[model samples]
Target: MTIRVTQPGLSTTVQDLGRPGYFHLGIPISGGMDRFALRAANLLVGNDEGAAVLEAVFMGPALEFTVDAIVAVTGAEMTPKVDDQLRETWTSFAVKAGQILSFEILKSGARAYIAIAGGIDVPMALGSRSTYSLGGLGGHEGRALVVDDELSLGQAGLGAKSGIHIAPKLRRSPGNPAELRMLPGLYWHRVTDVSGRNFFDDTWQVAPEADRIGYRFRGGRKLEFVDREQPFGAGSDPSNIVDGCYPYGSVQVPGGTEPIVLHRDAVSGGGYFMLGTVISADMDLIGQLQPHTATRFIEVTLEGAMKARRGRQNLLDELRASLD
Candidate 1:
């Protein structure tokens, strides 16, 4: 079976859980920005939790399926449609051969996942079918889908069926003034005590520069750095470090102005000093934030972060059980 792209939306790419263990080589773990939604969409279609699916950002693509298939749409609130007939988001449904699938304007959220039974049968690079566009690796020729691109479909598992619906409680979405819990990093000492307090107290708006690589926030007070003699190898700018490895979800404030939260496709290392990292549990929430959405950074202790991580895992467990 094959699916043909009729209209390639703003940014539609194939993604799975991601390509891990390659960050040291400068290859990021490129995958669905909203991983929870990706996994949910895949499970609803009877595909493996990490199976590759189309991740459409802002706008959605128009696809024409060549064969009957079980499909699911999740993540963003963009309503899915099969040949002009509206279908429910977060619910698996049937699409007959030659039926065209499209989406209405986005009502909420930033991206959506479209999962088909058997998943998108694309060649894997580095053990992942995810598209790392910057490196031209994986997915259909290593880029977003364009009109006329025909994607092959894998064999549907026995569990593939229509009408499977993810309960509302199982669905995840960003909250107004989304609260992102952050754990201060090694460079936290660089910022003044006043700046540190202001960071958490102030509300930041998502900047227009938000994308797969990182999210930049504006409207927050500029961070003031402590006076210090420049280290030999470090640049004169207070925000610059000699050079350091950036962990995933690191929040780096360039010039101590906008705080950028590096996401799935962010470069592994950089010279900028990071104030802290948004905790893993809250990273998914960042993906659903639309441009200009208000957000706040809440300080979290190591123990608190771990507890939240466990809660997220428990939620995933519940989702899996419900699908089963």
Candidate 2:
């Protein structure tokens, strides 16, 4: 049970939710940037939420599914075709043997998930099947998949038919202006009121300097100068002073200016403010943010965030109902 890729597009790698419980060893929670989409895709194909899936960047590779299997695509808005026909994403479907799947330029978002039944066959590293490019560990030889790469399923291959499938309501990509929500950071008051206002008021544009590791935004609106005391009152408050840990959705604002939103491949380290975390629910949508896209940060209340999370749970609840 495997599939062969004739072309691996710009970037492709295997990922699950992430490597948990090992952040203490300075292991970043390197995994899928878009957790929701990955989980949703897996659920669509009867795979566990932790199952590994292919996270494709930009367009995708042209590949042939040698084994008959079920698959689902999610995350970015890309034109995907299987056997020369358009394919529906966020839903499960069968791919006949020898069928080729091709991805065209992303139409809306920057990433997409292609989940194969039984999950993509990849060896686990550090108790997870994610790709950490910087460390060059885990997933397809510890790097982005290349042309002529063939992936195989491990134990419990897809033997059952896709009894049913559900397609989520297609979500449009956030426009050029995106008001991303953020929870108060541990160092919320570390910055001048002007800096805090700028952070929440000004719209920063996503710069070309972006990748799986993080996104660099321009026009972050400078912060006002302060007495610069022990890094306590200006936008320089770090989440922790420990050695290292899982850096998930942490926005590290360096020099009280440009803020980088750390993603899947962020480092496990200390010394940065880690001022805010992109609410877990929107991390995937954040992953889909395009280069040059403008974004604003709004402080979302904890109660409101909980409601948003529950709303997502409701969607999953409906999906489970469909499986019944």
Candidate 3:
């Protein structure tokens, strides 16, 4: 089966759970920004949770399927339509050969995942079908889909059936002034006590520069740092450190003005000092936020973070069981 793109949306790309273990070599784990949404979409279509799917950002693409297939759209509130007939988001439905699939304007959220039964059949690069556009690796031609691009679909499994839907209660979305739990890291000491308190107390708005690489926030008070002599290898700027590895979800405040939370496609290392990292459990929430959305950084302890991680895993377990 094949899907022909008649109109590529703002930025549509193929993604899976991502390719890990290559970041140390400078290859980021580029995958669906809202992983929970991606997993839900895939499961609804009877594909592996990590199966490659079309991740459309802000806008949705217009695709014409060449064969009958079970399909699901999750994550963003962008409504899907099959030949002008409206379909519910987060629910699996049927699309026959020659039926055109498109989406309505986004009502909320930032990105959406479209999962077909059996997944997108792109060749794996580094054991992943994810598209790392910056490096021109994986996915179709190592880049975003364009008009006339044809995507092959893997063989559909019997488990794929229309009408499978995730419950509204199970669906995840960003909260108003989304609360992102953060664990202070090695460079937390660099921020003064006042600035550190203010960081959490103040509300920050998502900046226009948000993307898969990282999310920048504005409208927060500038972070103040302690006065100190610059280290020999480090740059004069207080925010600069003698280059070190950047952990996924690291919140780097350059010039101590704006906090940027690095996400799926961010660089592995950088010179900027990080105040802390948004915990893994809260990272998915960041992906759903649209630019200008209000957010707050909530401090969390190591134990607390672990507890939250376990809770997240438990939710996924529940989702699978519910589907079964």
Candidate 4:
């Protein structure tokens, strides 16, 4: 079966867990911004947690299903509708063979996930089906959904059923002022004594420049750096370091202003000094942020980060069990 796009909403693309183990080659891991929501949506539709689904930004696509299918909408609270009939998000809904699925105005959050009964059958690149648009790498032709695009459907999971819903508490809310956890990075010492403390001392707002590659934040005190002789290859700016690999979720500030958190589609390495990195477990919160949304980064120990990671895995396990 296939689904045809009548109106492709802003930045809709096919994504799974994204390609890993390729950052060293300058390839980004461009998966869904909110993995938790993606997993939830997939589970609701009885698809594998890593199945490729539609990752829509702000708005969603209008799709005409060629065959009756069970689907779910998760992540952002964009109002989803089937042939103009309002449909509840975070729950599975059935669509008739000719029914049209469309999304209206955004109610909250910056992105949303749409999972079909079976995953959107796209060719995998580098062991994943996620789209890295910048490099024109994966997904449906490595680009956002466009009008007239027809996507094939994989075999539906045996458990694919309509009307399944995830609990409110289990859903990732797009509420403003989200608290994200971070761990100090390699160049943290360069700013520690000067203004590193201020990075956490003030609340930050997501900037308009935020995207899949990274999120730039505003409303924080100007970050200052400790005075020191510049390294040979480091740039003149205090915020510049010798170009080096940046871990996923690394936070870097250029010219000591506007802290930027690197995301799934971010470049592998750069010369900018990294102050800290958002913990792996809290990265999803970054994906849900809208422009002007407030955010706070709480510092955490390595052990605390590990604990949070374990907790997230356990929560996924529990969610799967409950759904099963």
Candidate 5:
């Protein structure tokens, strides 16, 4: 089956779970920003949970299917439709040959996931079909989908079918004042006691600089760092630290100003002082936030973070069971 993009809506790109084991080489994991939604969409279309799907940012593309196809839309309420006929999200539906699939409006959230039966047949680089557009790797010509671009469909997986719907409670909603759990990083000591306390006390607003690479937050508080002599090779700035690996979701504050949370497509290492890292379970939540969204960072113990991780995994397991 083949699908053609009539209007490539904002920044639609093919993404899978992401390419791993290459961060040391400085290749960012440029997969779907919203993994939860990606998995849900894939499951609805009877594709593998990590199957490559189209991730539409803010807006969605106008697609013309050349053959009858089973498809699902999840994450961000982008009001998807088939030839102008409204279709509910978080559910699987069928699109007949010659039908046009498009999104009407972006009701909430920043990104949406659209998964077709089988998957977007893209050549894999480093065991992934994800598009790291910065480095120009993977996906269609290693970039976002453009107008008139024809995408090949892979063979349907074991349970390929339609009419699947996810429970409303299980659906992810981009609510205001998102409370993200975090764990203090190695450079947490660099922040003053008052600044450290205020970090979690104040609600930070997402800045206009937010994107796939990282999110900069403005809390109106100039964080004060503990005074100390600069270490060798660690810049003179108070927020500077010897270059170190930046784990995905790591939060760093440069010049004691706004804090930036590095996302899936961020640099692997940097000189900024990392204050903490958003827990893995909440990373998907970060993807849904838009500029000016209020967010609070709540510190959690390592054990607490682990428990949350397991709980999230269990939720996914339950979702898979419900489909069967």
Candidate 6:
């Protein structure tokens, strides 16, 4: 199968779920920027939810397929077109062998997800197929995709049937706003009552300084930092206090200025007092934020967080149960 990239848009790369279990060594979980949409698109194409998919940020590359393939688009919706005809997102389609697929400028969120029946074939580094650009690890030479890159699918194929298509309900819609749901962080006590109130009351716009590493939000009320700052423990906060891990959700208020909520690719542990964590369920939402787009962070109690986790676990259980 020949897949050639004639134009690799503003920024495009291959990403799977993420690289986990290495935070202790200060490795960030660099994977699909928008996990939900990517996983959903992969699922629709009969590929595992965590399969490698193409991540298009702000724009996308033009692809020329040499052989037949089934594909789906998700996440921040960019009007993707095949040979200049406007196409849709989230729904799987059978593309003929010589068709050229291209994505225009962003019509909605920041990143777009493209998944095919077979996962993107790439050599795994440290048990993941993600691109860690900073460390020069996995992905296409540990960097973003440019024009003329060739991609081939994995051997784990889902046989494509004739005329199979998905419904509109399964496709991701464009221009949908994403909110970051979160729980109080370890330094929740350090925030003043008034600042805390403003944090939950107002919405912040995505700052220009955002990427696979983290989404930095601005325009919210300037938070007052406390004189008391403490260290974060290792083994998933609130546990034994070891050297903090590298990347995680940390609402860092540096210089007593606006908070920057770090996401998956964030440093494992941090010294900046954490206001709260965005939580796993909403990380995808955080990742899809467009610069200047509005977002609100809701503060939940520890009990509420546990409930949310359990609820999400139940949903996953049901999904897995269906397969069983």
Clashes of each: 0, 8, 0, 0, 0, 9
lDDT preference between candidates 1 and 5, better one: 1
**Per-candidate alpha-carbon RMSD to the true structure:** 0.6, 3.4, 0.6, 1.1, 1.1, 4.5
lDDT of 1 by residue, 114-185 (tens): 999999999989999999888889989999999999999999999998899999998888888899999999
Looking at candidate 1, the ten consecutive residues that score lowest on lDDT are 170-179
TM-score of each predicted structure versus truth: 0.99, 0.88, 0.99, 0.98, 0.98, 0.86
**Candidate 6 structure quality by residue, lDDT tens digits, 50-126:** 98888888888899988787888878768778888877776667667899988877877778888877878888989
Question: For residues 1-324, what per-residue lDDT tens digits would candidate 2 score against the true structure?
Answer: 778879988888889888887766767777888777787778777788779998888778787887777777888867668787887766567788889888777887888988877887788898899988888889889898888888997543444345355554534355568767788776666567787777888889888878888887778776653454443432334332333333567777767677888877877665656567777666776778888888988789888788878886787677666655
With candidate 6 superimposed using the best TM-score fit, by how many Å does residue 269's alpha carbon deviate from the native?
A: 2.9
User: Which scores greater on TM-score, model 2 or model 3?
Assistant: 3
Pairs of residues clashing in candidate 4 = none
Candidate 2 stretches greater than 4 Å from native: 155-176, 229-247
Q: What would the per-residue lDDT of candidate 4 be over residues 1-324, giving only the tens digit for each residue?
A: 999999999789999988989999999888999999999999999998999999999888999999989999999999789999999999999999999999889988888999999899999899999999999989999899899999999999788888998888677664457888999977888885647778888999999989999999999999878889999999999999899998889999999889899998999998999988999999898899998998988999999999999988888888888797
Q: Tens-digit lDDT track for model 5 on 16-40?
A: 9999899999998889998989999
Candidate 5 residues lying further than 4 Å off, grouped into runs, are none
Error of 6 at 205 (Å): 1.1
Clashes in model 5: which pairs?
A: none
Error of 2 at 324 (Å): 3.2
What is candidate 5's TM-score against the reference?
A: 0.98
lDDT of each: 0.95, 0.75, 0.95, 0.90, 0.91, 0.73
Runs in model 3 with CA error above 4 Å? none
